[model samples]
Target chain A: MPLRHLAPMLAALLALAVQAAPGNGDSGTQPEDRSHLPQLGDPYLPPAARKPAQRPPLAGAALQAQARAKLQQRFAAADTLKTGSISLAQAKAAGLGYVVQHFAEIDRQGSGRVSFEQVVSHQQGAR
Target chain B: MPVSLKRTHSYLLAITLALAACGGGGGGGSTPTQPTQPGNPADRGFSDPLAYSSSGNASLSVANEGAALTHHSLNLGGRVIDYTATAGHLIASHPQTSQPKAAFFYVAYTAKNQDVRTRPVTFFYNGGPGSASVWLHLGSYGPKRLQVGYPATSQPQPFPLVDNQESLLDTSDLVFVDAIGAGLSQAIAPHTNQTFWGVDADAEAFRDFVTRYLAVNQRTASPKFILGESYGGVRSSVLADLLEAAGTRMNGVILLSPILNYYSNCAVYSPGEANCTGFLPTYANTGAHFRLTNPAQTDYAAYAQQMRSYAASTYGPAVASWLGSRLPPSNSLVDQLVGLTGARANLWQANLSLHPNTYQFQLITGTVLGRYDARVTAPQGSALASEGDPSSTFITSSFASTIRSYLTSQLKYTAQTSYAISSNAIQSWNWQHDGQDLPDTLPDLAAALQQNPNLKIMVLHGYNDLATPFHQTELDLARLGNVPGLRIHNYEGGHMMYLDDASRVRTKADLVTFYASALN
Candidate 1:
């Protein structure tokens, strides 16, 4: 079978192994028996009653890449001189707020302009 | 491997020298320091939707593998403690279907040759709501600590790691577990990390993680404890209750610089409408620290106590005037506020409430006090500056770099994917809990107390912590009705109290007493 078709099968096998594994370890090590203790109800609100999750659709590198792409596009647009770099004034005009904020750090050589690579590397180091 | 080597060059050199002294048996297991990327989706056991490439190329996924165990000994002052470090991932699955949902990355340090039944095990996590457990692992009670001085930004070069004389390893085994989407933890296929980002769901995931950890390590009979810092406090409150339901009874629950209730956190309220009663004492303490108070109080604790009494007696009742009737604070109250908080009389008159930001910015000329730590200040930066907290900026790089070095070079657990020190999922966190839009976990804690009266609770605070004011935690825990099992201690440091050398020693001593009491 193709690998895509095998993904769910492997997941199922892993899930079965997970289910078969002992949970609470009532043996091996002497475990506490809390049968006499009062039992508590469900710890969470019912799914219908609970508030919906509010997480952003994209996450991890995918989200970061989207953001990075936007910045690069902005930089490209700002580099109207086609000198392969953007000056602080051009950055300011394009509303590249982050570039304007860290202009000195990005323009490390003090050339008053920064390449797209410099911006990318700076962001990676910051992360 | 070269990338890993480059990042850990300094630490690798140190480890090489140290191994030479130890006669070379202390190296971590044969697990590769850099894990090979999974070739296919099935190799990782599931398809990771998060495994995407911006370039539309083949994406990489973290391999599903067993832990890498390393053995080492630390000479903590004089007494040496030999410990085994287990660094890896444990799968947390769906409750009903038992399908793997998320992988929780954890680093566990257990004293070698200790009896599994008797040795205590404590789980530690820092709270960003989306933060990794790196802070508690490197900055606080772990066997090795990242050294960065307070009140000034840490220099990037020469980030050092030292044996933590105050490591809790002597008292109990420590396990630092990162939440899903943070550190090396990741969500499996069909369930995104967002599935566990809410208040209740987050607690459930942790409850599963803890139970799984116990079963796998055969630590079920050990005296159990959970320590949560900052937003981890919220997770702990709910987790404590959920763990009880799962039949894992903890001996103690520790809250460090916790925000137990968000309704009164001042972040939820508009400026001038926030409750100033809880914040007054913290402001007074900060003022005294800067010698900004009128009396030039040298004794910060005593001044804070005086302010606390005044707030409870006079300011607490008078707060209703502004919060309810839009009435101005009494002139006497205004005078007292100005004298204690170092704010101008006009500012206090115009607004009875003093927001932390206003105090942080206006407390001193040309300097901004840290929100996490009022004692640390920096020359104000541009409005669009990436980092706003002086406390965070100065010390963050040191901690960040040190963790990566320590993990790969020392602990020997490495990953292909970048370890996220913090995730951005908090931007869309579901705040609703127990029907309140703003979470108040005190009820969950109270329920845990009711269910397990034997559960010992200790709430710690730093007097200089502006993020979670000490007084608010005091007021929140007061509703538990004077339970003797509960102990609250405040130190003179910031939110991460262990960052201060003096506070770390004091806090460790306090924890030593707490662990003994709980175990007994």
Candidate 2:
């Protein structure tokens, strides 16, 4: 199943586990006892609440390629203050600090800039 | 990890050697020799001894409370060193067997020139697994206060200190603790930064501190109290539970602009059934205070009576309806309430929920120059969505100015570097705990009252504090029911209700009475 569909089922399962556990007042330490407290009244409502009129899932590879393109665009903007190579400070100033930090960890090649193939390589390595 | 530990030790050694060399006579005249025996292990007080000495000119004489305070650093189980310091003031003399703990504290008593009184000591702290007790130490109730209204760059450069006639020392002794890493406090061995940097870990550390304090101070008979602000309120609950388990008790617990329920308060800012229900009443009350609403009432009690009716009847339904359908008519009372909150009608018209940022900008821009001081309104400007809190700017500025001057000039504790007032270390704190998932402190509060029967709890809140809305607090207490001796008071101010003149005076009076009763 797609990750999007899997997310809710996982959330529901977690909630169920919490409900099954005993009450200890300390929510972080104990599994939540959902039985005695209060029930959601409707369990099916969540998925229905989130569903739009109509939507289609993008292929996983296509989604990855799209994400790579967006990241490259951001890197280009962040390289504005580059002195031959972009720096973290410049990336921070350009509002791409979060992305720059992530890319830095993934770049691995020691190159100043990242290429599409490098992006694909990093994506594969992550899995 | 071990390499980093070695590097840190080497750095400390180098700094110690540098200080020693500088003391051997450098640029200045004859060097003052380091005390060979370390100046009475009990008197190695205050992390920054120089800040207290050179800044204030008052003569130091031990008051009736007794011996001078002793300061020491404790390893709170982390690479980050925590200071476990206290002042030893004699409350009463007793036999060796009757002596409680040998306690020490850091205190900013009345300026040496002022008349001394047997003031009630109000113990205060902030919450954050990583937060120090600086918020109460400098911003709200300390003898040395921060000055408000000044640009960040336009300092004299360091502001002059003033005598805080407002200091609670006249009514109570104050003790501020730096939890784990945020302040001068450090963690003990075996417990790393991660160990002391979470919910349970922080509570256990405070529990240890309290246990140690009671054992050291002999204050077992003294009326004990706690004052926690923001997340500290949540922390106070956990501390209460731990203390109860240890058989210790408190006279009262005061929560200042507390964040008790993270899901209800912090996660949601806009007006929605899920997020905004708890906070709307406070927003309405603040609007009523600023004369933004149609009701031009100054008395909050009368206004609250009127608001409760509206909240249960009209306002509640209108919100439910608006959430379900297209934008309701502009003339609706809900719209008026939203408008009075200083939020743009269009935004409410668009999103139905008004985030804290919107309400803050909408309400104060015309009268105050900054977003923090809702009391002061600035000139109107083009309405734009704010990225973060405008009030934080004011809170940070006011605290920075007040604590710096108060610590150095009044109490006479000097340090090499400025005190760390607040940090982002606790911004993303999680409160969900395992096991009995208690409200953290309520059970302890119940136990304290059950144990003493005379213990009273005074819960005060500013009507305008959207940070911790009054209604949610009311609901939280409702779940706990009446504790027989507890009294709840609602003030006519925001998160820092004591900043308001009337509320501050009233709070002081109430505290004095409460302390007298607790002791008697």
Candidate 3:
């Protein structure tokens, strides 16, 4: 369960930066994802099918620990700017702002930084 | 719990949020967990197996009428789900002559596991009034997807596609549909697309396609679901009503980043108009994403929740009073609008209220935030923000070419007609249907819900999408006032939320849960 929670988040923050695809827009709300796609044509030869992209083969159970380790690395990297805590500017620039923003949301005591344990505790309560 | 705060915990908390979304448990409820599927390279097809000429874009006239089927398997939910991929045509013929004229195209994936009769079937499509199904197909739900580009990153050419781990094949069979004049589907000799391009007519055509598909596939007894994104979301609502009336009752309807109300989503509404207020929370969310908001605004979710409440209860009403000077405008109101929108109070006063378009460019002084995903910005794009969606451009660049590779190479569904992902059909579309309900689909949704109390609807939105902001959906749903079977879930991404790896996982789980809850 913990693994389930960590995988997508760690992946999403990185993935939102990646965009590829064709013809996905809608009128009014259409993504305009379709606007720039190159048109298709070639009468004789069949277009070679593309391979499907994939996440690493790690199971959900491994994702929790994997995610935690990756996060510590991220924090360590950001710590170069400021030890123990990443500044708001650092967080935004690193594209880790969503994490900081959410922590602040549940950081009820008005404390600048929210601890992992507090988040766990609060989440348990919220659930 | 330790009260000590650390910035690192923000990352941990994100995991929790993602987990909350994933924890809905998308596993097939009744189908016992089969042994974990072993990894098979061939099952997923060759890596970068698709290749196409780069001299120019592919032609749009080559289409084959043949129904192409390919067998495949993917490792999903820890199980190897074997399935059939069919790229087929649903021909629309003259009712009197019974002669085929035009053809509607679809790509379907039916899992080899479980009884075909009882397993759920979900039809997926994108909205363009004239768009193909490739967006939702490869972008979100299908097993294959073109490489997605990151913000500001140019996609590597010879666009590569990859196996989609987040494919919804875990709980339901998928059929991605393309409308007439899009993809391989087009108008026929006996029948012209002129009749099929309107709102009502389009709905009827889709209805008949589903009916014919079910009859041909012999899946009339399966649990049915309709999923449409963007304009497709609007279409999904109308399609729901049409399908039910056609005696094809669906168990559920799923709308992704849906725009249920056109007026509320767009237009120059008077200051404090409902539509203007709807953009408030989205504006804040985008601000937080880009760190444009006050640094003191730490908690993004809490901020958005508070904003939603204000928008629905207080701010929305306060803004509406500006119409005709019915209620004298107050400084406090302007200050509140400024506070909520993060733009200058003077700007708010000048405009009477902050519109999404005005704020789109204003939030960040130089670049424009994408309409599909407000968090992403492009300095060179049109400031109007209406020229096209920047975020979507990044996606289509990859998908447009990749699908051709998929259809021709993978599915072997060759056609003499060229594939049109985004079609010109929208240009000729007839919008004059029923004035009683302008362009909004909320009325259709309400009636559909009433007609079938058993029907379930799940409206989803991307947190970053300004085009169909999550908060606007909240406002619309609130107006609907808690119908029994309708639920709303917002993922942490833009219009095509699934493009974001995290949102894709979260959405797959959400869709799976919706299917299970509604169908089971």
Per-model TM values vs. the true structure:
0.71, 0.58, 0.68
The best-first sequence of candidates by TM-score reads 1, 3, 2
What DockQ does every candidate get? Answer: 0.01, 0.01, 0.01
Among the numbered candidates, top TM-score falls to 1
User: What fraction of correct interface contacts does each candidate retain?
Assistant: 0.00, 0.00, 0.00
**In candidate 3 chain B, where is summed lDDT lowest over 10 consecutive residues?**
B46-55
**Which prediction has more favorable lDDT, 2 or 3?**
3
Q: What are the chain A TM-scores of the candidates, in order?
A: 0.45, 0.32, 0.36
* Candidate 2 C-alpha lDDT tens digits along B1-520: 3323433443343233222222222221122332222243323333332111111111112111121222222122232111112322211111112222111123422211111122233467765434556656655655444543322323432334443445555455467765544443433223333444455556656666665444433334445677887667767766654454344546667766665544444223222323355556666667776677664657777777666666667666665565554343355654666654544454454334444434554444332222222443323331111112233333454565665554544334445545554333332333334222222334334433333355556677777665566776765555445566566678766666665556666876776676776555
State the displacement of the C-alpha of residue B233, model 2, in Å, after optimal TM-score superposition: 1.1
lDDT of each: 0.67, 0.45, 0.58
Clashing pairs in 1: none
